[model samples]
Target: MRLPCIEIIGCIAAIVTVLKLVTLDTFVFGDVQETFILFLNVHFLAALMVVFALAISAYKYLRLGIELMPIEKYVFRILISLAAFTGIWALSTEIIRYFNYQELTSAKSVSDIENAKQLA
Candidate 1:
């Protein structure tokens, strides 16, 4: 079943709205830092979904014997490759951030202990 262009656009808009709602925060009642992190996570998940959908569509086309032109095939391959690379890059960045955060908190706690010892 083919979706009309307007319906597709509406669906995209609705997705964006939901994303906005999920990430919404106010300075009076929320931590901006946490909200930003949540936004990044949401964005990454959306990207992953898009990549998965593209892969599935490509697979379906191939299985159904629907042939793409040479240029189309090249573009599809390039997009898939880029998406995979981006996903890897994002994962690595998040991993590094997690380790850094752990290190920072550990260092802070050690310093706090030292300060407490000095106070005693």
Candidate 2:
């Protein structure tokens, strides 16, 4: 049987996600840069890849075109659901942190402007 495109996509996404997570801290955070620490804390990139992979896998299973053994199907479904949940959780946490950073910066800017106006 021909392998489904979705499965291929999912596998590739999974591999890419692993590579990003492994190399992100080492290459990006290692002795070269320190200023982007906050942005890197987001973890959005890895989580997004995971979610994409899970979504594709889920779609493939839902379509029911690929003939998978019963056990294999069950295993994939469970794994996909669990992975999707984890990805969503990570994504939400990172998004919250990103938004918080934005809010803090905006507030500081507004405060600085107010202080400048008072001085003027």
Candidate 3:
């Protein structure tokens, strides 16, 4: 049987999300600090796209009669999934922040020194 349009869109979005995440460094268009700032926004948008795809897929499966689970049942599933996804993302960001704490602090210090020198 042929796949539905929703499935196609979801699949394409999923692929794009994965590709974007994997090659995040290449998306930089400027210096490291600027690139990091831009990357934060891009990553959030990419994550939203992934959640959108998941929503579409869930709707398709529910309405198309693929699974016998009731709509009410899926509400819990969706909530749990969202919580899990958020938790993982939060953990990842913390890990990155922890590891790069020194680099980020140093960058700020360096910028502050430059600004002070300019004002003196």
Candidate 4:
């Protein structure tokens, strides 16, 4: 039997999403130092959500005999994905930098700095 197109698309989407999650969480970019518990949880959860959403919807279309856009439409999908991914990268970088700056600017709170300084 012919494998359904929905399955095909779902597989592709799942692979891409998981690969991205790995790259980000593994610091494959060489600069990701996010060790914060919250950020790690958020990234994993978000990736899971996106994977389930895309996979389920693709499977639905296959079972219902609905037509997914043909391969010709993939170019548009790719372009949109690129734009959204770029935006995400840009925004995450900005937020991380802002938080790091905040941490640095906070006055010393221990003797490690000067013993009787801002901690008092």
lDDT of 1 by residue, 27-83 (tens): 122222343352265444655665465465445445544454443444345445544
**Tens digit per residue, CA lDDT, model 2, 1-120:** 545576566566655564555456223322212232443643555566566766776676667735765544664665476566656566555555655656666888999999999999
Q: Please estimate how well model 4 matches the true structure, expressed as its whole-model Cα lDDT.
A: 0.50
All candidates' lDDT scores?
Answer: 0.50, 0.58, 0.53, 0.50
**Weakest 10 consecutive residues, lDDT, candidate 2?**
25-34
Clashes of each: 0, 0, 0, 0
* Residues 16-69, model 4: lDDT tens digits: 765575466533322323433334445434654664555455445455443444
Global lDDT of model 3:
0.53
TM-score of each: 0.51, 0.45, 0.43, 0.33
Residue 43 shift from truth in candidate 2, angstroms:
6.1
Q: Is candidate 3 or candidate 4 better by lDDT?
A: 3
> Which stretches of candidate 2 lie above 4 Å from their native place?
2-49, 62-66, 114-118
Off by over 4 Å in 3: 1-16, 19-32, 35-40, 66-102, 110-120
Candidate 2 — what's its lDDT? Answer: 0.58
Window of ten residues with lowest summed lDDT in model 1:
25-34
Residue 120 of model 1, lDDT score = 100
Which residue runs of candidate 1 sit more than 4 Å off their true CA positions?
1-65
Which pairs of residues clash in candidate 4, taking residues 3 or more apart in a chain or in different chains?
none
Better of 1 and 4 by TM-score: 1
